[model samples]
Target: MRIRLQRDIDRLKKQVVSLATLVEERFRLAIRAVECRDADLARKVIIGDAEIDQKEVDIEEECLKILALHQPVADHLRYIISVLKLNNDLERIGDLAVNIAQKAEVVASKLELPIPFDYVTMSQRAGEMLEESLNSLVNLDLHLAYRVCAQDDEVDFMKSAMQLQFAEEIRKAKEEHIEPLIHLFLISRHLERIADHATNIAEDVIYMITGEIHRHKGFEYHHSEE
Candidate 1:
């Protein structure tokens, strides 16, 4: 029974990791579409969101089945529960990526604006956080999870900076750049929300490792000096 339960846990972990990979790809494509102003790629990303949603539901069903059949105890139970919660977070991240893609689609018809911030950087940071969080989960590394959580603030700061830069650009050329400015703001907002979801998953990993709740409480986000 124990071996069977472990197998089930392993299977679920694989499922979650698969979902993460798909979502990460979506995020990458969304950023690419923004950079190149590729409306078709953005549309593809939006359409792919349905796949992520379906995969999330499938993962949840697997978790439920394992819980019902195995009734895992102690750490095993905690891990399964954490995966279930993290799965939700991953799904939401996918939705945010799709939202960004939609924003890019809307702005694609207009002339591209000269913004100071790079969508690539923000998207890369979010992707790194997602990768690190999943790594922490697979390896049971609380420290790595905490580090991923800390980087969320960095992503947030970059997003805000992008927004401010876009706002300034918009004010300078209101009529000429209004469409791109609106889309840029929307895309930045989506990236911020994606970082938040990644942070939530990281916190869940930390909780899975430590057995302590850290949901609503304020946690300091540590930044590395540049």
Candidate 2:
């Protein structure tokens, strides 16, 4: 019975890692599609989204099976619950990537807008956060999870800058350019949301490691107050 429980645990971890890999690949592809305005690659991302969705469903089933078979208690129970929540977050992040790809397709169909701002830095940072958060989950590292939470501010700042630049472009440019501008804005929003999901996953990792919930309270409580 113990060996069987160990196998289930190992299987659950492998499934989560696989889901993370797919999500990371989609994120990279989405960014490339945006940068190169490659509708074909963007279409590929949209089509591939279903696979990620299926993986989430499979992970949930595995979690349920383990719950019923092993009836995990205490830390094991917490770990399964965390995995369920993280699985949802991972799937949502994949959807955000799909949204970015949709924006890419929209931009590809139109005349290329003038070079105003590059999303390369923003994309890179968000992608790094996603990767690190997943790594933290696999390693069960609370410190790295906290680092993921801290990096969210940088992603938010980049998103704000992109929004401002796009707003200025709208003021100065012709009406026809508005379509591409909207698409670019959507892309930024999707990237921002991806970072948000990564933050959620990091918080879940912390909970899994420490058995404490910190979602609504925020990190400020960790240091304060009188």
Candidate 3:
């Protein structure tokens, strides 16, 4: 029974990793669409969301089956529960990527205007957080998980600064630029939310490893410059 349960758990981990890879690729494409203002790329991301949704559902079903069949306990149980939570976070990140893609479509249609926000940098940081969170989960690296949680605040600061930049731009914007400006603001917002989801994943990793809850408390682990 133990060996079978471990085998099933290993299989579930692989499935979750596959989903993570898909979601991360979609997010990167969404960021590219934002940078290039490519509606074609944005459309691809939007269309790809259905596959992600289906995969998320499939993973949830597998997790349920594992729980019912094996009745995982202790650390094994924690790992399963953490995967379930992080799985949902990953799906939400995919949705946010689609949101960014949809906003990119709107921003693409308009005349190019000066964007005061450093949106590309913010997107890159958010992407890194997502990558690190997934790495933590895949490798069970406690430090990587904690590092991801620490970086969330940086993304949050950029998002707040973006709002200020948008508000200032709004004052001087001509009528035609208003719509694109709004979309840019929303894209930044989505990126910040993506960072939030990434943080949630990191927290789940910590819980899975330590068997201790660390939501809203990961900052305590941010010691050292490593």
* RMSD for each of the candidates: 3.5, 3.5, 3.6
| Deviating ranges (above 4 Å) for candidate 3 | 218-226
Local distance difference test scores for all models: 0.82, 0.88, 0.90
Q: Residue 82 in candidate 1 has what lDDT?
A: 92
Per-residue lDDT of 36-58 in model 2, one digit per residue for the tens? 88999999999999999999999
lDDT of 3 by residue, 159-195 (tens): 8888898999999999989888999998899998898
Ranking by lDDT: 3, 2, 1
Checking candidate 3 for backbone clashes, the offending pairs are none
Candidates 1 and 3 compared: the better one by TM-score is 3
The candidate maximizing lDDT is 3
User: What are the per-residue Cα lDDT tens digits for candidate 1 across 75-158?
Assistant: 999988998899998899888888888888877777545545677777788778877887787788899988987777688778
Candidate 2 Cα errors over 4 Å, as ranges:
219-226
